[model samples]
Target: MSSPLKSLHFAVFPLPAQGHMVPMMDIARILAHRGATVTILTTPVNAKRFNSVIERAVEAKLKLQVVELQLRLAEVGLPEGCESLDMLSSTDPWFKLLGAFDMLEEPAEQVLRRLSPVPDCIISDNFIPWTSDVARRLSIPRLIFHGPGCFSILCMHIVTSTSVLDGIESDSELFVLPGLPDPIEVTKLQAFGQSKPNATKPQVSDNSEAKTKEKKGYIERVQEGEKAAHGILVNSFEELEPEYAHELAKAKDKKIWCIGPVSLFNKSDLDIAERGNKAAINEHDCLKWLEGREPGSVVYVCLGTLTHTSLEQIIELGLGLEMTDLPFIWCIRNKTEELERWFSESGFEERVGDRGLIIYGWVPQVLILSHRAIGGFLTHCGWNSTLEAVCAGVPMVTWPHFADQFFNEKFIIQVLKVGVRIGVEIPVVMGGEDTAETLVKKEEVKVAVECLMNGGDEGEERKKRAQELAEMAKTAMKDGGSSIRNTTSMIQDITEQLAINV
Candidate 1:
């Protein structure tokens, strides 16, 4: 029989953030591999990041393409190049970025209307909930793409769907998240929108209040969009979090297709190394560094793209890594001149010397994690980073900065037992300023690293568990695996629905 996805067109929209856009691109490629004609909707700046992947897809003769839309940045009072989250300044208000995303709706609708074969479905990032409306207007099914795993999604859903936060007195007060397969303990801050005790709230002027109100509406619309969509496309596999996955599907009453660790879909070395951005360090140089280290003897440190680490924290981290005396590869993003000056003046780099390799920009994180020498990862616990580490069977030193990261850390440390936390007590959202004042000192960092990488029964067990999950992750992508079956079912369901509609 012919593939159900054959000739079916899918217009995929990803929110213009690294975490959001990367997986959505992977999903687009995955769908095209299953014989679907996939068109990715992206902005000019965001589209450039996917050039390599898109080229490879086309070269492989896959029916995949990217449509770059000119976002009305000036109309929204955003700067010309402020298309993605990483491009946003610390001073830029969050609502203005949302306004820029709002501007894409009209152009997106126009593009969808003009496509040669009408899209059978709209697969969109959960953040860009406005795409649901575009799907509605175009009379196509919409599938929400949730980048985080079922654990985080389930926690968020339970908290949002009910008045769980009603009458909560303290941000640190723990409550069991109701209606979950497991009694997951969560604090108000952990859930969402809770503030620290005696914390000075941002002074909201009338104009700022209006913008805040608008942002609230945007969040509500996101939830509404999910409710209205036909299903959710999660970058996860059933074996990874079977209970949470089952619980989430039951709670949402929506078709939840867990088709991921989507990075695995890219089999070629070039595709793997160059998955997101061109490697800042040469891929060969990175591999050469790893090759020199003994098996499971190196610590890989990367705190994801959006994390803004202060120089003080960097020095502390540098000291901690130096203290470990382990072979290490650390990738630093958003490197400031002050950071460079510190490295030059303090001789910190010289002290670490050949024992440590630091890439001051983007590194091929997945490639590095999969290396045999990588013993552990010191990470900010971003979902993409978390999933990548899990697939590589590498344990983590969790230091979550913001968004769903804290929840993801819980899943790693508590549920999976394959990681340890570095004791970041409060969550900090990116507002373009130094939000991560809850600095984890050097002692905590050193201890966490030792706990995850050192020779102890606990450490050995963590490694064993992580390896098991990694095998399961790889298995899920193979034929008859959970992910492959889910992908087929998703396509078949979409095709059957379209037939009924026709």
Candidate 2:
């Protein structure tokens, strides 16, 4: 059959966050490779970051382009160079950044208008719901790209749509989420953005109330935009969560495309190494460090980019890593001067000696996870990390921090049986002061790591299941695989819908 994607043009816009942007870029590459012309729309700083990916795609002769939209941070009352969320110092600027993103709609629409071949589809990050408006004006279909997997989205839908939380009084009380293939256990605390009921609440500052209103307005728009969109494009595969994927489609009443483990699209070593930000450690150095270790002997720890660890939490985590006495590679972020002082005074570097390698910033996560020496992962259960660990056949020690991570942890530990939780219950908002007290202590961390890394019947069984999932992930990306078939079907359906609208 003729490729439905042939000569089609797609406009891709991703939110300027690590987790959201990376997968959307992968999706763009996937579409270009599938014979669709793709244009990635973003601000100047983000456009610069896409240079490497764009260059590689161009070299391979894929029809991909990037259009830069300069963000007016001053107009939005945000600092200059605050193009991405990571650049912010506090949560205060978050809403302002969202406001700045709103200013881009006109420029983006104009850019779309001037393209030689108008885009047939607009695939934008879920946060940028105004793209639905752009699609409406241009008379093209819009598809929302949800960063999390089908299961998490389903859980979120249930929390919002069903009476699941009607009588839940305590944060730690467990409840079974209704309408799923498996009875997934979830605490009220695990619900994303679930507000706490304080008996004696502090008076809300006028400024805080304004910010809350702005946030609420933005969230409502996003929900409405998602409903108005033609469908959803998720970074998941059918075999990975067939029932949940189908259920999510039914719940949303939209055609959901599970075309993922999208990281697999990076076939070359250079692509893998340079997938996200430039690696703090060289690919050769990282591989050399793992070369002498025995297979399945090392534990790789990284809590993702967005999460911040307090000095107290860092000390506890460091202590836990020391207690395990296993070969490890930990990628840490937000290295404060106090943390450095503690590292120096605590003799952490001298004690661990050559047994542990600490990367202070970005490391090539995908490459490290795929290494043979990687036995277990200490992760925050972000969708990317969870899916990457599954793809690499590495069992996880899940320590979910917030957002969809809690749901992801359950899916990893309960559904897949290839992970162990570190016993964190309460969902934390970013930049909250109470994080130090709520974090998993050293004992919990040590025990979970030991359980995952040490070889036992249970550990071996987990390894077996992980390897099975890895094989499934590989098959799903191959020719005639579930993910590939989904992609083809999505393109064909979009084409039919566009024709009907015409």
Candidate 3:
């Protein structure tokens, strides 16, 4: 008799965020490298991005495939190519469910049924809770990629399904989590408007009560779907957060695997190294702008795609960079009007002409961070950004925005001590507040940047720690390292299962 096939086929559903897509693609590539047939499912917009990466992957001979799904919203008459989250934001929760229920779940199920050879398993984003149900219906074992640290996932599980936040009085700091060794200040929780301790969900006026009620119901449905997922896949190293991972394993009945620092898994592969080269952004016609600069001279400032800073904040940041007098590259996304005019009128560009370069739109974040000239990062503390910075051995100036950014900021500053929090008082805005309570002034930003760039006693200490963590991250991704071992084990398990099924 012919030997049974050992190769597995995996279908991955990645959320649209850059952070989510990149790591999921990495995992898919790794599986394909190990002789599995991998197909990634993403929206058209994201699929295009994945295609760019896949083109590079193919040129490098990494065997993987991508499938693009058309998200249907014709009943509401929305245009094609709209983001999944953006389309759902303004609509009632029930209306949003139509996309997950009718659009995503239905379409995904159809694709699976029609596959030439059905997939052996489905890997999905935890954000798309409906995926679990679809996988179950297809009799495919499902894995939910958490896309963040175990602590961050555990925190979200507590905040979303439970009344943990309700227990904390407004403006009062309560130690809110159970899994971690130290108490997590209630202010550090990542939920709707919780980054700023007092920041609360936006309250609807009398005229919008009906819309508000619909939103509440929508949230309930989403939560219900989240509770049904089979297993959780965390993109973190057990060595980095053993305590939190253990706690999560106990609290959640699902299998948890710490397979990460995924970016570093294939440094020795020439093809993969060349693929990394494509992520570089070209601006100002100077690719090596910071070449030969002092080891700790440049400060790389990048706020992720989703964040938008006000003109006031922009001006303050520019002035702060000037005050620091360090070579810097700032990646700014112009999502609002008047930002360009304000920069020109303020003469901020002239003030730091050669000292800084501010590029608009997306940046080659990974390449820039990995550069030797980039000694530190002024970041929004997004999980991907944080992990990249750690891998690159770059320290950070933490300025958290929304969602799990606050939790990431805490881990970097408090737990890892590889970075410094820019402002002393964590800003808190009570729910429905009209104005922000704590604003990061220009001087504070300057001091933080300077401290990280110029090595003072404390800066030196942080610098040493940052370098050590960077080495650890690098070691973990090497052959026989923790991340590679876990990935190999995962692939072996899937292959064995596929053999039995076949």
The candidate maximizing lDDT is 2
Clashes of 1: 1
Which scores greater on lDDT, model 1 or model 2? 2
Q: Where does candidate 2 stray beyond 4 Å?
A: 1-5, 91-93, 193-207
Worst 10 residues of 2 by lDDT: 197-206
Candidate 3 lDDT, 238-329, residue by residue in tens:
77777878878777766677777877654533333333223334632434686746766889998765554556777778888888888898
Compared with the true structure, all predictions reach lDDT values of 0.83, 0.86, 0.68
- Provide the clashing-pair count of each candidate structure: 1, 0, 3
Provide C-alpha RMSD values for all models, in order.
Answer: 2.4, 2.6, 4.6
- Every model's TM-score: 0.96, 0.96, 0.86
Candidate 3 collision pairs: 198-429, 198-430, 199-429
Prediction 1 TM-score vs. true: 0.96
- Name model 1 segments beyond 4 Å from true: 1-5, 193-207, 433-437
Candidate 3, run of 10 with poorest lDDT: 426-435
Q: Evaluate model 1: give its lDDT.
A: 0.83
- Model 3: what TM-score? 0.86
